[model samples]
Target: MSIQKIALVGNPNSGKSSVFNQLTGLNQHVGNYPGVTVDKKTGSFPGKEGGKIKVIDLPGIYSIYPKSEDERVVFEILKDKGHKNYPDLCVVVVDVTNLERNLLLFTQLHDLKIPTILVVNMVDLLEGEGISVDLEKLSELLGGVPVIPMNARKGEGIEALKNAIYDFNQTTWTPFLKQYATHDHGLKHLPSPSEQIEDTDRRFKKITQILKFCVKRAEPSKSRKLISNRIDKVVTHPIWGYAIFLFILLLIFQAIYELASVPMDLIDNVFLLLSQGTRDALPPGVFTDLIAEGIVPGIGGIVIFVPQIVLLFAFIAILEETGYMSRVVFIMDRLMRPFGLNGKSVVPLISGVACAIPAIMATRTIDQWKDRLITIMVTPLTSCSARLPVYTLLIALVVPDKSVWGFMNLQGLVLLGMYLLGFAAAFLAAIIFKLIIRSRQKSFLIMEMPTYKIPRWSNVGITLWEKTKVFVWEAGRVIMAISIILWVLASYGPPNRIEKAVSAIPIPENVADDAKMSYEEQVSSVKLENSWIGLLGKQLEPAIAPLGYDWQVGIALITSFAAREVFVSSMATIYSVGEDFEDEATMLQRMRQEVNPRTGQSVYNLASGLSLMVFYAFAMQCMSTLAIVKRETKSWKWPLLQLVYMTTLAYIGAFITYNLLQ
Candidate 1:
């Protein structure tokens, strides 16, 4: 069967992605566009007579004459004829309730002369507002393009939309191009205009003509204005809004801790069983130990947080769907202005909870270069899910397992404080950056406050599932690979090293069996300081020693750069090698019991625990974030700078904390 490509394009909050998801269902793959951080979501659908259709969801934009980096990406892709993966058909999704504003992009697409099918989404919203669009007249005015009115959320008009796509032909849509040229002469030129006036004028003329002919409203959307005003009163108020936002944030953090515990415990126990079963089934050997202790536990460390990650995404998706996120941006914009950020930066900064890479990528929405750069630089300060395992484990070890104020978990509050510290750091850095780089360009915030809609459970579920799955698969691959490598590194030693040492030491005859032990047994039975890993660990002991880390902690630190969560796995791998511990909790308890050989003091006291948490909180410890920064900035300069600066800060902070506590 032939493969036909369809691209979904729409303004932000126009239900473009919802339409894509409804049509494609579970058949989508998300990855970066060939050379950009802009997400490329492609999916397949069964076409008429068994033909296959490929659909691409382009980033939302206001116009083809782009303003922000993300909007420019949409224009770049649509205009580049030489680009691979060009769309064969363009499905321009417009919210029927806001046709005048939504049709701006549709008219731009028609000017591009792409095979266009107009999808008037949110038709259900029109009738409720006492507004109605004449489909036939609108279709005729749009130059004979197939116009399908769809309620994308309810699956209404989807079959007709699919048929429209299957029957799409460029030849049938030339009149729309002709009409645009005749009515909006600014669009007719030999090549794309160079000056800002010419470009903006052209887009404005084209959109104005489209709205004049095709759109009619019963009355201005009073509800949109009224609800926006009402919500804005409480949410964007200088005093109350900030307080409410903080309370909401705290509630989410507390809930994440409380709700995720049961599922996390179940996952931990399941993995423990798997490891124990592997150990019991296999012969007592190095390979068996690697599988049971290193690989299983290492992978399990990342997998256990899937529940929490999903919950985070779920809350975010619901906020977005309900149009509350826009209010958040509006409320925070005034406050963020002093910090060289706009309201839009709130989305990316909040998204940093999932991962800094995507959050940094999302900064493309910021129009100003200085604002975008500062946002990208400081977004990593927001605590990501990768930090959760480390924070959870350390908090459990230090904070008592009890609640305060009859509602807040003490450990959860500590976790909440860590997140707040990250936010505080981001704000401080942004303020400093703003002061250092002064630009006088006035960028106004023009955001569309969409009508609040009830949260669609299916949509929210799909979003949460997709995000959590990506986190698991991407992070899991790196963790599992690193675990195997670490296992090998810690397993073997120089030849005759153990035997020679044993021979040199005088032993009683009654303990001959202990002396004649096998190589694996001797390696496992020996103290870590006498092993190869221990030697390497000791070599770095001097460097991190002032930061309250022993050689073993230094080893974990070195390995954790692969990912922040790997700290837990590294500790598990190191501790599980010769011990009989069955699970992570037991292993953590054993670590706390460990004493420094020279000082005869506990290894993981309050000082060391605080230092480690501070280090992870500040350090650029994830290779994934670095790789993404390199990809986005297209230079080693930024990521390298990020790594160096963050690592220095982490070192200084850890050093201070350690010394003060000691």
Candidate 2:
């Protein structure tokens, strides 16, 4: 037999992704479908007789009938046989508890005459809910389409599901909707989306009739929803709910600060030694300088923060897998509605903590045009993982590492404060946009609360792996290139200008041996100040001077336009070029000891460090985020305005912070 292609279709929170994960394990690939931003997941697994079956995990939707562009893309791919991702067989996974609602999608697929299998999932919850399914009878009712009862989390029924996939064929079958299936193939003849509601009502009526015979329900001995409802009383409490969320945020930040310090220090020292060793092992030349100063330390600058980032992603993944994040959305809706944000806006806003790009993409679910535009414009204000390094670096530089009340890490408290500030800024910005932008659509929050369960560790592991891979690979390339370019600019200058400046620095005629080394250091500093990057930084210094930043900080502000994390790497490469790599001092130490030549004061003092942190908190420093905004809004006008407004806000915020601290 030929290799079979299968598609997994289901409603949200139906354990469809879990089924895909169980089947594909580590063989999955994530990509976008042609001409759209929606993710397309494909993987291969062994079928019966050791043949391979290709599986596509389509995005979750309630139905195939299009109500939005994303839904349209998914609908076309499923309905069109000529489409590249069209499958030979379709697997509809459904939550047995909510079978009526989920079966709507399955019935639509069935009536399309697609060779399909029905996977009745989450059967483990059946006993708790006092429900049972007559699997053989249900298959007989659907004209003998294969039905596999499954508990995907525990890997149960996977073998049976595989067998059903291989056994599927286009037999003469009775569709759930007979009349619609006969003339129109279920939905092909609908004049427009305005009429889908009538057809949907008819399908639900038939589904209600079918469920009456093939399913049984009674008062539960112990309802799982009862336990969940009890938990929700405390979790969704108006006051305590927000308190618990804040407490959780506190613990996550504290863990990040307390646990990551040792690993971060280790990484910092390892790179220092590696840079020194590279210099020692290779001939003293420009290539050696480039490797020892540019590439190694640049990548290390971002890599040192990976431990903290991993901890953040892990906590988020675990929260999501446990179904608590939905509660967060449910509670936050009340708080957000006043700010002109839909309850659905909470998902993208919360997701923005990881990265703004996907978070912006997540806004596609918001139905209101004005709300989505506002969310896109303000989401970058959230403190994403890209800003974590910048925050941790500055906080460490200015805030003393100690306990507040002998329990809380003072530094972690500061870090949490930065995130809180991001949310506040986003909300305040949303209010302003609400006043300025007009829309006729009324907002509402409609969502499902899944029964809470112990988090699936396999899901958490995969999340960490994918997030880490993207962070390293995407950020690494930009940092490496910028570092190389900065190194060349800092290492060389116009003609003999660098040589003339260095040669002009006179060694004291009767200097002590120790002071001779100091004289050589002065010459190196003179050479660096005359180099190309230094001149560029010097030109920018005047514009940024009121914010308490020096020329070096100005250079970082400029390069950070590529990505927020590049700020740290920019500093690392800049300092590495003019310093002695053989010293045991790490980049953080050098930053601490950095002094202004003119003022005779530390460069990264509290006022300047705090100013820099505030600048980063509000700045639109990411080009990729801008490109995505343009694509999502379908115009250059909004992104350009976003860049202008955010940059202006950052400057004013930083100025006030610096002056007040001083």
Candidate 3:
């Protein structure tokens, strides 16, 4: 067999991914099927014989008749004999507890004439649930297809599974095409999709016949079902479910604030020391400034937030691994329906709180184009981790670092409020987009609620690791480039003005005797004020000054288009290079004392801090998010709409906040 292919196909919650992981341990590659958001996972391992077995893990689906684009991928490859992905062997994973529903998809693959083996997964739950399946009889009913019962999670029967694959591959079973061609109806492939109904009905009748001959059942206890249902009583209840969900979100945000703060501070201090060391150790030049100010602080900006990203992804992973994310989807479905989104959309929306790129990718699970587009468009409204550093910096500057009512950290509460604000904005904007977009297709929420179990620690760690890599590399490149450009812009100026501006900062007699800012400080200020970025910041100042921001804040606004977190690094670089250093002060400290020339007051007072925070809270600043949106929508229109609506909201919200606070 030359590169024999095995495609893992099963219904949702059938433990197919676990089985794939077991079969191809530590040898997997994840990529997207060209031009689609659906993930394609392929891996290989040595077989019982001297050959290598290539495994393809396709997305979970209920049928080969393709309800979504994701499902269509399954049908396209399986139906085309010459397609590269047409599997030489199909491993159909079946959830032993929910074997009936899983068998439906398996039967579809059988009718489509694909060589297949049935892997009865999660059989460990069978003994506990008082159920048993006869593998021999099941194989006999399906024309003697190989059947292997295994608990994929514990690696039980993995050796048996490998042996079965080796045997099956050696003598691959020819599909039972007569089952479809000889049906009394004499049905063949129909050109229209609706024509599959009669064929599906025939398949169901055959499935019932197979179950009668090959399956045995005992009355199982209702305790497991009751446990889930009872929990749903509060969690899925219309009125209370919303309350519980809000409480859960609050807990997540509170943890982000309480847990991630220490690491963030430590990272900040380390970067400052490194910068100082570079300046002290090396000769002053363009290279030294680039290393000390540009690259170091740029990298520091992203790595500083890793702790928060990990915590966010960890919580989401555990929720998904425990099967609670499905309940979140079910409950939020009702809340989302009026906004013209499916309950399944809750996944993407919630994921957006971590990052919109993956969140938008998560929308692949949404079958309807209209609902998925709406979800993608509004997901960015949910403040992601990129905005966390910006939120933290601004909140610390404006909100006092004290507890409210001796219980809550006032800053943490404000942080939570900002997140909630982001979510609310997303919800409201989704409603507006819903009204504008037109689609004849219906929306649905057909999701499987996998049995709740203790989250597998290995799976959770893997999830955290993968997501962190994406965050670091994807966001890291943009930040590093933007930081370098920003430093150059802030460092140099037109020769005539660069020199004259330094001389024009008239050192008062009081400045030599009793001035608050030294002559050196004034010169540093004028130098920045005349630099390329400063010139641009001044040109844009009239527009942002309405929000009580000066030209310096305006510069941050421009550079942060690459990412929201770049605001932190931009400010760090700008202030570090713009101010004369006595003792190294943190970004917040320097921001606090920096005065406005016109008003002679602190540039970052409560009004401007809140204004800046609100601006970032609603802005569309991530280029990657826009690119993904363009890919998903297959057009620039929706992403453009998102950019316009979100940027408008940011401006309006910031304007109101500044004037109101002032």
Candidate 4:
């Protein structure tokens, strides 16, 4: 059966993505358009009478005339009829509260004449302010195009939308192409007086006329505006805004620590049992050992952190949905300008806390090259989700879980401080880059503040699911592959080194053959320390010893450079390769017990944990991030400089932290 193609387009924050998620459910996945960095999301669902409809969620843009790379993608895909993914029908989502501004794009799409449906989103928001749009009249004004009032976040109007889709007649409007005419046939044709007015003025005039025809609103009372302004006065005040932003961050981390502990402990135990069960049921062999020791532990290290990941992203989504994040952006922009960044840089900088990869891609929307490049260069300094596993593990080892000052969790406070340290480092680095780099272009932050409302839980849930799933799969693949490789390298050594090491251990007097478990553990540990991977770690021991890391940590450092989250997996394999699996202790417990050979002290002390945290906070480790930086900058000079500068900062920071904390 053939599937009909439909495209969804809208200005930013028009609920376009919410609508897409509502229609497609779990069927959609995001990919990039061919030869572009902008996201191209497509999905399909069953339609009326055994038919299927495919939907494309295009990048949000304000107009067909592009101002940024992402906007250019929208123009190319919509205007180029021969483009592979061009839509047969277009659904233009319009934010009804901002009707006049949104209609400008809808009007442009109408001129292009691609069988359009106007999705008047956020209708639920209008009634409270005594504003309304006559849907039938709006449709008539658009040449009888279908108009659907929707609250996509609540699943309202979905059935009507589906019915409209089933009843759609693509042939009703012939595809009009003359408005974008590029040819100059019979070119001498003269000046028509109508063409004298600027195109922008004409679009604005049409939008105002349409508003008179269909829209109705009550002007807000002076008192209401005054109250909002008063609230903004404090919320966006220079000192108060920064204080509120910091307080909110602290509150979020505190809640994550308090609420997520029970579930995280449950997940940790479940994985422990799964690993132990594999050892008990399966016949003892290399494959059994691999499954029980390496793969299970590697995956567990990441899986155990799911609760934290979910809570972190859920809070972020809530802030955005409520329109508070935009206020923070405005506040941050005021603080950022001195460092050569503006409020627009806050979006990517905040997103970097989730993951540096897509956060870097997000910089494409920043119109100024200099500001965009500065954001891209220093973004990795902001701790990401990949760092969460490592931070929580180490924090547990050193920082007590007890309450401090009668209300705060000590560990949570440390977590908040660590995140702030990353931000501080990013700003300082930006300032340094600002002093070094030269630019003559000026950019302004043009942002619209949406009306504040309670967060839609449905939208928050969808965002949490998408982000957590992406984190797991992206980290899982790299971890599993590296875990298997690490097991092989740790288990066997050159030319019977394993056999020679085993045979060389002297038998203890009065030791029964059946009671030789301790002896066997000793032999295994010795064999692993002499294995190929161990030797490599030892080679780097001299450089890292000053920073409180041993050979095993040295190995994890190298492996995790491929991806920061791989540090957990690498440690899982490194520690589990020659250890007992039925002990029921989580990886954190095992790490806490690890001893430093030279001093006979615990390896993960307050000093070493803090040192490691500082190292990751400032380091450039992820290869995928660097490759993306190269692609985005279109130059190796930037990424190479990034690698060098970040590594230097990491080493010095780690050195200072270890010495001071110790």
For residues 622-662, what per-residue lDDT tens digits would candidate 4 score against the true structure? 99899989989999999999999999999999999999987
TM-score of 1: 0.90
Worst 10 residues of 4 by lDDT: 182-191
lDDT of each: 0.78, 0.88, 0.82, 0.84
lDDT of 4: 0.84
Query: What is candidate 3's local distance difference test score?
Result: 0.82
Q: Rank the candidates by TM-score, best first.
A: 2, 4, 3, 1
How close is every model to the real structure, measured as TM-score? 0.90, 0.97, 0.91, 0.94
Question: What is the per-residue lDDT of model 1 for residues 48-119, given as tens digits with 9 covering 90 to 100?
Answer: 878679999998888877666777677777776555766887899988777777776787777676778889
Judge candidate 1 against the unseen true structure and give its global Cα lDDT, from 0 to 1. 0.78
What would the per-residue lDDT of candidate 3 be over residues 446-522, giving only the tens digit for each residue?
77777778887777776687778877887788888888898899889887888887777776777443464677677
Question: Best candidate, TM-score-wise?
Answer: 2
Models sorted by lDDT, best on top: 2, 4, 3, 1
Candidate 2 local lDDT, 136-194, one digit each (tens): 98888777888899999888999999877776566786767666546443345444665
Error of 2 at 327 (Å): 0.5
> In model 3, which runs have C-alpha deviations exceeding 4 angstroms?
2-5, 21-29, 43-54, 86-88, 111-115, 159-168, 172-174, 177-191, 364-370, 438-442, 505-517, 578-582
lDDT preference between candidates 2 and 4, better one? 2
